[model samples]
Target: MKLQLRYLLVFAFLCFFSVSFAQRKKEIPQTTRLLFVLDASGSMNSAWEGDTRINIARQILSDMIDSIANVPYVEVAMRVYGHQYNFKQKNCQDSKLEVAFGSRNNNQIRTMLDGLQPKGTTPIAYSLEQATKDFPNDGKDTRNVIVMITDGIEACDGDPCAISRGLQQKGIFLKPFIVGMGIEPKYAKGFECMGRFFNAKSSRQFKGFLQEVVKQTLGKTTVTVELLDERNQPREANVHMAFIDQATDKARYNIVHFRDKGGKTDELDIDAIPTYDLIVYTTPPVLKKNVEIIGGRHNVIKVATPQGQLNIVQNGSLDYSTGHSAIVQKQGNHEILVNQQVNEPHNYLIGNYRVEVLTRPTTVFENVRVNQGKTTTLNVKRPGVVTILNKLSGYGSIYVVKSDGSEDWVMNLPEKGIPRTNFALQPGRYRFVFRSSEANDSSYSKSVFFNLSEGGAFTLDILRL
Candidate 1:
């Protein structure tokens, strides 16, 4: 009995240990992998302050690696270019990944940097292209970062800006953190689109820039999408929102705004970036393009999408079908606002619109204003349908002439085989002019005056012309 008890206790302890280990593994977040794209071209040997640019970069990078030694779930790698070939050898493809990304790889990186010597041409663009393959193609949870330390621009004929932009568009890597070692001010403009350029003039400045870059790459920032009502207040919540990359127009983050216990909008932790396009899926959809988000700061985007209810009434009946009514915007170009049929009242963005009702004569209410948080009720008068029974054996079209002698083309009455064509006309006094398709003279056509006032169907018999 004693031996059996002791075996039972051991089994219980092993089961607890297994469960604890699995829970701990599940708690660990995804790794942040950073790649250092070092430039070892001949220009790196030039003196910057009291030491060569390469030497300064090597020392600062070593120290930076040491500083992050205690950070959890972090991996680092290094790639060097122009260090293996001579300057006159024309070796533009001299870049190589010296150290692959892994934890506790600092000693390998430092040893490799110590042995590198600046010799060949600077292939900044080629090195960056190669670095894209060094990262593991794991799930999207892993954050891939690149820190480019270079003193000169691309010596090869490759376009680094285009390469960087392409990489970002492909979602392979984030915006690179470029530490320009003693780069001239006039030449700095050339690298504006490559990445976030940090012009380091001295050793201290270089070290500080690297530290900041590491902190930013390893950290996350908060972004809040404030859905504003008509009064520009943050009273709206539970709306779907998307953060789109401006370079690619690809959605990077999507979330629904819900107030927390503190009655404030919930903030999301997104990878640090310079700007994003905030898109809100409101009634009519709202877009706030090119919103800038600075690192280590809380960003709040106040999106004004005040909407009003549009209730359309046809004649004396309420018709919610969107097919019968259309609200179009009156702006630079006419844009249709609401066209879908709604059995109930629907919301629309507050603006001026032209409400068109598909009545007999197609009633149009121009300059209709939709106010915020209020219902804009539109009542349309139905027009009378007029059917023209043609007895003449000819192809012709009918035109309606108004009191001012202005003519509007109605419908074409086909050849003698077709008996009639229908026309929806509003309450008005007008004259109908019938012109034969083969006739060129206006006097050869027939004309008649007709007045329509009631909202019902009527037939006009054309016994002769």
Candidate 2:
């Protein structure tokens, strides 16, 4: 009888500790609200990539809807312009809303997209005005986004540029990302300017334009953690962490970095560690033994006592692989946070507190080349301090100070290595320079002269320094 009583007590203690470390997430859900203004005017009847503009628009809208449908707390609304284009009648009223503001199921959205037929004059400006009115402005904290995909210029009254400006002035809520789908080169500028107007042009190039917008909507943040290594400098590669659902103990971390479909270092694939919205990545100390972990929801994971501590690093993506292993060395109630929203007091409590240590991965990049008014591709063999001609780190923008120090060359690399941009720049001796928001003087890369005189197209790979 005493043995059974002890077992029950042990089980109760474990349960208490496990429940304490878990956190609760607030239900104040937010969404990256999106609006798609698709042009279905007669001009859209033209062919693009062997498909009609109407069909292409349908495909793009459908694909985007499918991609974002699974993400919780996201709502997408689409509006079709110039659906009833009437060149002979020249009626601006032909441009009207095909779908109102509301939640759209995939099939419903797809159906609405299919129903669009190109038949009216292109009142692209009128369509913009209509979209401007469609979005609700209840003064909520939602992030609104509007994406206008058109293949022609304004076909009715009101200047499209002025209309764009007006929308900005109004609380249309989100910024606009205009896409020129096979439109004339002359008009592409006007549409591109719309993105600039909203300060949404993260990339000056064309390839990753749309994809970058999507990535930005996914949300990004800087992870900062200070740890006492008792050794030399702390390295991120030695640390690991993962996203956990506050409701469950399921977790997954970045085990490897690969070139994503967009071909940029800004992406990481999160494998399913468990079928839970949140999971604890590290094996915490055994003092909180026999803890039950629920899967498939936002989870809360925390320590049981204040004595237990977790180590973290900053300035890079956190990795939760084996580095997040934890242990229990003390007893008492403790708290930890699973996937709590940023800056929220969403800590979970735990009994018999254990520490789950997480560390970030460190990367070293070398042999970076920076050229002026040139498109150069720098290949970092592995993730590390990538320098261009011994200048900037990682990828994107690389600044170079000339040997004579007479001028500065600000070179931009395509976020992805697109074939058109690969081997696109002329070869010359150059030095590397780093540009970052932080005021870290030592982070700058050393100056090196590199000549791209290989003549024929050749791949220059960057190795670890």
Candidate 3:
């Protein structure tokens, strides 16, 4: 019995170990993968701050990697360009990933950095495009980052800004960190749209910038989007807000504006590296430009988006079967802003607008004012139906008899076939002229004048004319 019990306990331990191992494998911690795209072009051999640009970049970056080597849930990789061919070769496709992202890859990257030689032309755009593939698909949440170190603009005549923007739009990496090594001011403008431009005039500045960028990459940054009313109070809610990168002009975050029970906007975590342009999806979208958020903290962004309700309704009727709506446009502006359905309420920025109901005759109201925190109600007259009954199919025309003794053509009946037709028209006076297909001459045509009243129906008949 003792030997049997020993075997049972051993089997139980094995089962427990298997279950625990499976659970451990399923839990993947989020990681931050930083890829360094270093420039080893011929210009990097030039002197900056009493040392070659490549040397200063290499030593500071190597020390920095050593400091971050032990951080949990973080990985690093290095890609170098202009290190393969001589400057005379002018190789534009000379970029390669030296030390791919892996565990404890600091020693590998440091060794690779120390051995890099600046002998070829700069391929900034090509290097960035290749670095996108350096991140591994680990089936876990990962934030891919890039830090590009360059001393000169693209000598290979490639557009780095466009490449960086394209990669960001594809979610390949976050906004990159560009460390410029004493580049000329005129040429520095070219890098403005590349990423967060950091000018490292000396090795000291480069080291400090490196530390800041890494710290921000691992930090938790948040923002509170506060939409203000005319009273400058946070009262608006349930609108869409887009956080766009100012450099790329692409939307990085699109979120529905939310508020808590206390009517306060909630905080949102966002990337601290890229500057943003906030677009509030109001009736006419309001643009708040150059929105920057602080790192490692909660930021409050306030924009005045005062709004009011617009309710278009039909008096004495509620018929959704008509499927009609009003075209809303700003006064003196022909652009249609919203096609608001009848009996429905919509919100728009407080302003004057023109509302044109799509009912027959098209009732139009100008200078319709929407005040702050108030509702503007437009009541339209319910339509009247005009039914025509004929003995035979015929060609006919309907005209609106204006009060000024002028007539406006409204509609035309079928040339032949159906003997019945209907028109939903606003309350007005109209004249219907009809000729039966059996009529021998035009003089046999019959004309009738009738009045259509609101919420009433009128029928016209032709006696085989």
Candidate 4:
């Protein structure tokens, strides 16, 4: 009796522990919502690949629902278009959600498909527009997916591409997986921008395509950003990374290195797809386009963004100018990169650049190379400061003529009082011409030539001249 009691107690304790562990290991409930937009137009009744297109679609879609029936936390919905009115009825808005999103909806979807018949004209775009209302937007972490099966293009003069784009923008759906049954390759461009369009000429191809779509919609992949250094080695850290979906041009993942989690760069979990653009924020932004992330695989992307610094060195001191500016342009094509007032040092990528200083005669420095991890100093010759004291008490205009015979109007001196005008002239030979007018009288002019050098300040009294 004692041995039997001890055995019973041990069995009970083991059973309790097993049950507790199982409960702890259970997966969290993540919602994966799928909506099927089927084409039940008159064209689907035509015979194709040894059976009607609608019949083949019904069989394949039913099989797909059955395959995912036991998938936990998944909800499925169905919408059929053009099955309500006759082909000549002109009913473009004949679309209905036969079964709303619900768990274990395989039987409901199959029953609805069995009763569907090809009747009205094709309204592909209108049907897609109505599909936005089929999914719930409760702000849960649900993967909203739309699988559109159709045999023809939009005959209702509506833009399906624009609708799909809007739906993806609203976060109501992913890029709709379009399966074109018995569609010509030439017309495939119509649905190219709608989503990942697959041209299936037969039922077998359609089945494979559907399977692939399901796998992609349900799987997740890993993405690692390999920041490359000067030697093209993956050693850079503290980079801001963004993964944008190329199909929708939407940012799906954004993270900053060394800041998100104790300066550690971990792999990112992303939806398994082929069209992602990886952008790494560095000195000059780095972009890697058309990145493919396959299921059950680790994707490592190497981004090379070697950078250097630009230090503007003023050779001489002249405090006459309030702001200094330069324009950095690409060497060959002269594409402007930086413009406006730039006084401090800044970092740039490793490339040849041309610096155009916004001064008298516009000084230009060409073929300036920014080495990796090093600073390139540009020694610029400072201009001379010239101050003119107009004691004649009249309105006057100052002009500086260059050696090449070109002249620039410097400033206009007022006539009310003894006014002063200043000019920051480049270090060269310049002819200064001044025109003055006495109270309501004709004007008189005078010209003077001066050799200006770096850091030189000259003051001229017009009355004495």
Candidate 5:
């Protein structure tokens, strides 16, 4: 009795652990790097809230650093623009990384910001372009973020919208959180397409916007994809998927969907920044656009991707000696989606399809319905064998006779005919015409007609010497 009780307890523990692990995911460490881009243009020296805009930015950023300094698995860096040259110099390329990403280095960034001055042009585009190199080359588990605090538009000829878009498309970092200080409508409109834009008209609003950006940056995000069936249940699995960043027009991630033995789909952890367009690679493929994933939570994205199985099988004689294939195409369009092998079951998204079996005489099935969670079985009558015996080398071709006495060409015999050959053909009337390879005149051709009454029946023909 004690032995049985111990076994049951061990089994329960394992089951609980598996469920917990799938839900919360394994406790693996993930890194998130925050690169702060501060604008120190000539306009920042103007008065704001009884203090210079540069001074206000420095103070608020320093406080923000204090809050994030103790965050585990998070590193911080800082970059400043327009501070190295004066306004008289008109330098549009003045940008430098004052502090590289490092752990426990909030003091380094804070000190650098204190001594900064708003002296030169606002090279917003150039600064953002150079910020790509600030991240490490390889970090599959890292999420890099950029928070740009600016007071002026781009003084350089570079396009800020295009530059930021290129970086986002390259996945150099998540969508940047751009906060503008007292930006006018015209200037704010320019930054709108750049990234997630926020306008901070007052010092309190700036602080609040900064804090909200920080809140968004914190947390390890995970995604739970539930591919639902026709009944809205997550019973569909075993398909590949591509997650594309719609705003950036870039494919961010690809994963194959699989269900655990306990009926739970596998969990995927990706950056929570972009709104994805999901493409499920079923037979015909299914697309779900603008899938929003939330940060700091298990973002469950449900896509109704029901699928059904298709099996093209022969009923009687399994003559696999001739490899048969079926051209699978969508109804009303002849575009071939898959060339499936005969007698095999394949999964396709629920739809109507046209299937053409590649046999000696082609068999076509139109408007074949594939329903969710069911197999649409298509059975072809087994074929009969046709044996041809020839004593001499010849050129010949076989044709299938239609009901109107017209014939469809099936195949051409080898120029060097064999002594005997066997062909698996459907039950139909066929004609064979032959001419010795040495015969150059059309009158030298000879013909023979044969019929296959039923499947599994053998028909033999001889080319008289």
Candidate 6:
């Protein structure tokens, strides 16, 4: 009897251990994976006001990483392009990944981010494909994100948006936020269109685009669901229940039972609902059921960190820098941009972040180009200014190199930023090419040639492309 009792105790201990292990597995933190797709194509080598844009990008990214160092349970990953040897001979076909996905150890990520310089053809599609592999959809509860920063249109084969959509269709909600650096205002439309489609535009208001992205991943909310009938009426009048993460793509459902409307309620698991349809009063005489529901409003309560706090937004970036609070008691799924700002260096952590993200900038430009006589009458088309702007402040200066290889003009101006310059010469067989001061700087543009009429008036139209 003694031996048997000992054996029984051992068996019970084993069962307890198994149960504990299973519970621990269930409690693992839901992960958010960020993939940094830094452009290393040839066009990123230019300098901005003598400062290399690549260097600036490195500093900014480093600062960002340092800012988020204190955020709990957050991990980051990075990948770079244009590191191919003999990239020119390869027709920019060699846009390869130098760093695979990995955790952002300050030292490791810093080294990788700092070592990047622009060069090579823009293989936007290929880089995205490589990054997708970093986020495996094999039943892992991880939110995947792709932050692609580029300054030019794609030079490699395959469409970036199509590739991103394909990944999304595969159960991977890949939100791609594009950062256009050192690109002309005329070409900003395509980037804006991409942001609109993905619902992830980095508002140009305060350079808080990337910061807003970080806040979005860190922010959480609790939603209360009160199921209503097809008549657009509330079934459980004034009976409140809470569902966590109510307004986000990832929602946690918890049901509460209030004995009566406006009365004390017992918090219960959502699964405790009598039926999947969540209908009560299921019995005899009345023969009533909260049957077949549709077309009802959902109230989404978005809560920011530091608990029960609020933020005020100006433009797309946050104006409330320090301790500020606000509540959003909005209903329905809002596809709106939220911005958060952290002004002080020490307060740049998760709870201290002030979230903000602005709407697309107001741009004024029609698709028209007129080439006039000795004085080429160029119309200034943009909401803010006629100067060139660098949406993505990385890579390097953008050099407008003439196809003849005679002289090149490099630009790194902000909004209404750089002054326009005119060229005096006999315009014949001239093609415009762009260059960057990065590792992938050798990729040239398709040469377009036009003849200059010796005396008669000749017109040439240059697309934003």
Q: Candidate 1 lDDT, tens digit per residue, 67-126?
A: 786688899999999999999996989999999988888888889989988988989889
Task: Name the regions of candidate 6 deviating beyond 4 angstroms.
Answer: 1-26, 85-87, 90-92, 136-140, 185-189, 192-207, 221-465
Show where candidate 2 strays beyond 4 Å.
1-24, 137-139, 196-210, 219-465
Tell how far residue 391 is off in model 5, in angstroms: 2.4
lDDT of 6 by residue, 81-135 (tens): 7655434754545555455544556567788777665667777777777776666
> How close to the true structure is residue 317 of candidate 2, measured as C-alpha lDDT?
20
Residue 419 error for model 4, in Å? 6.0
- Model 5 CA deviation exceeding 4 Å by range: 1-30, 46-52, 136-142, 165-174, 185-189, 201-205, 231-234, 244-252, 258-266, 289-292, 316-322, 458-462
lDDT of 4 by residue, 1-465 (tens): 999999999999999999999998895756989899899999999999889999999999999999999988889999989999998986999999999999898998999999888988888889888887888877777878888999998889999988888878776677788999989888898998888888897799999999988887775667677776689876567667888877568788888854244534578788764368888776457888988776556777777878778887665434546567788876886567776354578767789888887776567789999988788988778888778877666555655666587876755656654658777766776666555555344435677777778878888788776
Q: What is the TM-score of each candidate against the true structure?
A: 0.74, 0.40, 0.82, 0.69, 0.84, 0.43
> Model 1: residues >4 Å from true position, as ranges?
1-31, 46-51, 69-73, 88-90, 138-141, 227-241, 254-263, 280-287, 304-309, 315-322, 335-350, 382-465
The reply for model 3, stretches above 4 Å from the true place, is 1-30, 41-55, 84-94, 114-121, 137-141, 169-171, 244-252, 273-277, 288-295, 316-321, 414-423
lDDT per residue (tens digit) for residues 1-465 in model 3: 999999999999999999999999999767888998998888888887888888898899999899889989999899899989999999999999999897688888888888888889889999999887788876769878999888888888899999998988777887888988887788877887888888877789988888888877777788998999999999999999999986567887999999989887888989887789999999988999888776767789998999999999886444323678899999999999989988889999999999998877678999999999899999888878877776567778888889897988877877764657677888889888987777799997888888999888988776533
Which RMSD does model 4 reach against the true structure? Answer: 11.2
Which of candidates 3 and 6 is the stronger one according to TM-score? 3
Between candidates 2 and 4, name the one with more favorable lDDT.
4
Query: What does the lDDT read for residue 426 in candidate 1?
Result: 60
> How would you encode candidate 2's per-residue C-alpha lDDT over 1-465 as one tens digit per residue?
999999999999999877766633444656556777777778878765666767866776687677777776666787776666466777786655555545546777888887777777777677777776676776655656777777777777667776765665554543366766666666666665454312222122322445555555554422222211223222112123445422233343433222235432233333111122322233231132222232122222332211112222222222122222222232332444232121122121122323332211111122222222122221211111232331323443433334576544546554333322232222334344333333366554333344443232333333222
Query: What lDDT would each prediction earn against the true structure?
Result: 0.77, 0.47, 0.86, 0.80, 0.85, 0.43
Model 5, span 1-465: residue lDDT tens = 999999999999999999998878756667889999999988999998899888889999998998889988898999999999988998988999889998889898888988887889999999999999898776447888999999888888889899888888877887888998898878777897787788998999999989878876785578888999988999988889999897667677988998998999888987776778999998888898878666667788888888999999875435546567899999999799999988889999899999999876888999999998899999887788777787668788889999999999998877776888887888889888888877889899888888885565554454562
Q: Least lDDT summed over 10 consecutive residues: which range in candidate 1?
A: 316-325
Model 1 lDDT on a 0 to 1 scale: 0.77
Q: 2 or 3: which has the higher lDDT? A: 3
Rank ordering of all candidates by lDDT, starting from the highest: 3, 5, 4, 1, 2, 6
